[model samples]
Target: MLDDITGKVMVLENHNGQQLEQQPQQQQALQTPKSGVRRSTRISRPLERYSPSLYYLLLTDSGEPECYEEAVQVETRKKWEQAMKEEMDSLAHNQTWDLVRFPAGKTTLQNKCVYRLKEEYGGRKRYKARLVVKGFAQKKG
Candidate 1:
C-alpha cells in the first residue's frame, strides 16, 4: 500500500519478493467547479509589472535642485485600542473630568485640560472628548 502520511516512514511486507507496479489508468479525476458558471478564484501572490514607462522628475525649490534622488516614506500599521485605553485610564485616574450635572446658565470658571474617552455603541466605540476646567479659577465674562 502506498501511504501519503507526512514525516513518517512506512514498513512494507515484501511477500514473494515481487516489485509493485503503478497503473496510470486507475487514477481518480480531481474535482472541478460546475460547468455552467465561472466561480471566482482569489489570487494568492503579489502582482508584477514589467516594461513600464519610466519618467525622471526633477524636484526643485526656486531653481535649486533639492537632491538627485527622490525621497521615500514607508508607514507601518498599528493597533490604537491599547494606547487609547491607557490614555483614558491615566485621564480617569488623574480626575481630569468630573461627571456632574452643572446647573443651567452656569459655565466653568477655570482654565481646563480637554480629556477624552471612548464609548462603545452598535459594535463600535465612539470617542468622547471633553474640556475639563480647573477648580481654582474665577469666571471671566
Candidate 2:
C-alpha cells in the first residue's frame, strides 16, 4: 500500500497469486460538494525529493544491544553511557531510591540497560537507552 496526495493505492492478489492493479485515480468519479457546505481547495506545491537513506532506515529494524559490551562503536557506547547517566540523574533528583545496607539473606537484583532507536515526528533519529529492572525475580507485594 502506498499513500499519495490523491488517495491510498492498494494492490490485490488473486487466488492463483496473480497480482492485480486497481483502477487508476482518473477513472474514479468525483463526488459533488454537499449543499450549504463550503469546500476549501489547497494550492498545489512542488513535491519534496525522496531520501533513500531515510526510506531504508524506516524500513529496517535497528536491534537493541544484548549487553553493555555489545555496543560496537565508541560513539554508540558513549551515547548509551550518557543516556544511563541522565536516567540516574533523574532518579536521584526524584529521590526514587535510597542506598541502604543489604539484608543478610536477601539478594539484590541487578538492572539491565536496553537500547532503542527511535524516530521523532520531525524525522530525527534518537538513540535511547533505558534501564530496566529484571522484574522476573520480583514478587507480588
Candidate 3:
C-alpha cells in the first residue's frame, strides 16, 4: 500500500542494463560552461567625505584616535567666523606682546602659557580657530 501511494513501481524485467553503456566521448557533451560570478563583499565602517579642509577634536586622552569628518552648516560657519574674529581682536587689544624690549623681566612669572580657545557664539554649536601668544615666552628687552 505504501509503494502504491505515489506511483506504480516497475520491476526489473531484464539484466541488460550493463549492455546499454555509453561511449567515453558521449560524457563530454553534457558539460556546460562555468559561471564567472564572484561573491559579494561589504564594508561596515562609516563613510568619509574627502574635502580640502578637515577638522579634528584634540582629546586629552593620549592613546585615543579621534579622527572624524564633521559637517558644519552655513549659519554655524558664519557664527564661527564671527567668534574667531572677536577672539583674535580681543587678543590683539590686550597687547599680549606690545610692551617688549625689556630686560627679560620676571623669570618667576614666566611659567604661564597663554592659549586661546574657540568659544561658541550666536547660539551655534560650531567653532572656529584662534591664535594666542604664550605668556611665558614674553621677553623683557
Most accurate candidate by lDDT: 2
- True lDDT of residue 7, candidate 3: 82
Candidates in descending TM-score order = 2, 3, 1
What lDDT does model 1 reach? Answer: 0.45
* Candidate 3 deviant stretches above 4 angstroms: 1-75, 99-128, 133-141
Best by TM-score: 2
Candidate models: Cα lDDT each: 0.45, 0.73, 0.44
Q: In candidate 3, what are the lDDT values of residues 50-94, reduced to their tens digit?
A: 322333322332222222111123324454456557766877888
TM-score of 1: 0.22
TM-score for each predicted model, relative to the true structure: 0.22, 0.49, 0.24
Clashing pairs in 3: 101-141, 102-140, 102-141, 103-140, 104-140
**Candidate 2 C-alpha error for residue 64, in Å:** 3.0
Decoy 3 TM-score against native? 0.24
Q: Candidate 2 has which clashing residue pairs, if any?
A: none
